[model samples]
Target: MNQGGNKIGGADSASRAKTRASGGGAPSGGSPALSIVIPAYDEAGNVGPLLEEVRREADALGRSYEIVVVNDGSRDGTDRALDELARGDARIRVIHFAANFGQTAALAAGLEAATGDVIITMDGDRQNDPSEMRRLIEKLDEGYACVSGWRRDRHDDALRSFASRIANRLISKATSLPLHDYGCTLKAYRRDALDPSQLYGEMHRFLPVYVRARGGSVAEIVVRHRPRVVGVSKYGFSRIPRVLADLALVRLLFKYRTRPSHLFAKVAGYLFATGALVGGYGVVRGLGKAPILDMPVLLAAVLGVGSLSLVGIGLCCELVMRNHFYVLGRRPWRIARTVNLPDPAATGMVSDRTAPTKAVQGHAPL
Candidate 1:
């Protein structure tokens, strides 16, 4: 079946509304609770509307849910809008960053504060329809830890559409996780399936890869994509080179993160073999009365030393990686604050959730 651009038409609207109206009842045991984390950057106009839509849909689902809108240092009226919204509704919260730390950082902050059985991530722009969240959650019930949205009928310009297609193909090939659309942020993830600490830079695009690398199953569903209602796209072609560089790093991390020696082993072997061949050729030529200080001899000598040096560098890298993982135990994820989190003691379970604090600059709590 062609899974591309399966639009929800008018006929489906009545059925969808019925399904929604039937929801908002008491959640049964094993029902998937949700935490919708939206990262907003200068999206003042869309912030309030997005939250309202999410609230309506999430409440209709009859699941315990919270909408965490991370204000990514928006210079606009986004902060004011979030403050007014959060003051009235306890289910809505905001995390105000000290500066514009990019979307990935904003997402990392939101994931840390999230306390739900399942976390939903979407763009702050209204382009990602909230109605499709039900579809993602429905697919998540099929024993998949992650459900990514595919914008089959994207509404962007031709250049962006073409660039996105190329980027998706390259990322899928590099990560070995074939996804139709990696740019869509509308995805549902199991609470324990991923570690937010492993994310950095624009690595949010590789969330599916990270989940799969941890042995978690992933599925994709076609979701409705709308044109932007406000603001401009922060991304451009200039970011492609950065994405390509990050893709290479992600590939290496996924392949040999746990056993880094696997990455260096083959390279080391090749380097040593090349060195041996070049040195051996030089020695063989010497027996035929070839000049010892000839260009071939010097070049062979350089190649031999270079190979040994590369092997040494590889060993050093392996040790550094091992020490960092075993000795230091570094974790990259951080949280500024949380709201309405369940009490661990009353629940008879302790979580990695940190203590809450107010908004502040630096690594200060909240």
Candidate 2:
């Protein structure tokens, strides 16, 4: 990002990223020092330039690096252009998704394929600066599982800005990360510190929260923000509603993520009690009726069935959530490899001495 905020991209642009991906190749001797995963959706205008800038920045950091661009089923020439650029830069990798599966899915695919000690994720658009990547990496090196970029003076339309504010509040509340910007794409994560199985949904916005859930600390730094100077935004106001709905679901899941039985039992108990009250009223009304059965009895019957059904559903979901907990714990993720084994710890683009490293890969303490 630049102070002037003229968001444009070209080979000479500082924000240019290089995604030279080759399919599951041999572990490439040792993993690159840092791997950048960028998600692009109809960002042909910006993607080209962002790639170039990432290459230059990585070189300046004095570390081996690889950049992977995940083209989220762009209808533009993004795929072909990335492929063409790959011919010139072996450090760049391109992952082309078959269709638009949203940014979360695109990022998930890139993370699964990445081979690096420290991982960085940013938008393919020129808004997120490659220069700021170092800042995030630096913070990650300070014993933080993830570092998020806070866009100071954002340069988007008012509606987009306002919507993002709402989302950040709700997400911060849920994840308890308390960062100002959850939607900001500029972020860095210690590869082994994040577990993919513990992630899903638009949850990518709350990567820090997910990391914290696994006992990782999250830090934030101010990063410059730039306005869009190319094609229109791919996801517009339509995403606002979806994001709010998803936030509600995330809140519910987080509250009862591990022990859902508590949540289910509470809901069921309340409903069952309410139903009993209705039935008691019905019984009293029936005693005063000319006939034993009446409209009140029908109302009571409907309420009883509805309450029972809700209770049953809640109980069943409780079992399902518990059953899946073990599945998630046992599944393969970025954490198990970095934490459990005797392998070296993860690497970062920046080095700091005060911070504790979560996972080790045999290099000097840096």
Which structure among the candidates has the greatest TM-score? 1
Mark the regions of model 1 whose C-alpha exceeds 4 Å error after superposition. 1-32, 268-366
Q: What is the lDDT of residue 207 in candidate 1?
A: 85
Instruction: Report the C-alpha lDDT of model 2 over 1-366, residue by residue, as the tens digit.
Output: 332222111112122122223233324677786888888889888877888888888778777778877777888888777877777787777766556768876786567557787789988888888899767765555456677788968998888788888878877776555777888888887776665534444657756666665555667788889888888777587777666655655555557766767865886787677768766776766645745345655566677778667655754564454335323232111211111112212232111211324332321110
Clashing pairs in 1: 336-366
Minimum summed lDDT over a 10-residue window in model 1 is located at 357-366
Number of clashing pairs per prediction, in order: 1, 24
Candidate 1 per-residue lDDT, tens place, 1-366, comes to 154222211111222212112234323563335789999999998988888999889877777777878888889888888888888888786877656777887887678667777789999999999988777777666467788899989999999999999999999888878888888999988876666655555778888887776656778888889999899887789888767766866776667667767766876787678768776786767745765556565576677778667655754564454344222323233333334433322322212233222222121110
| Every model's TM-score | 0.71, 0.69
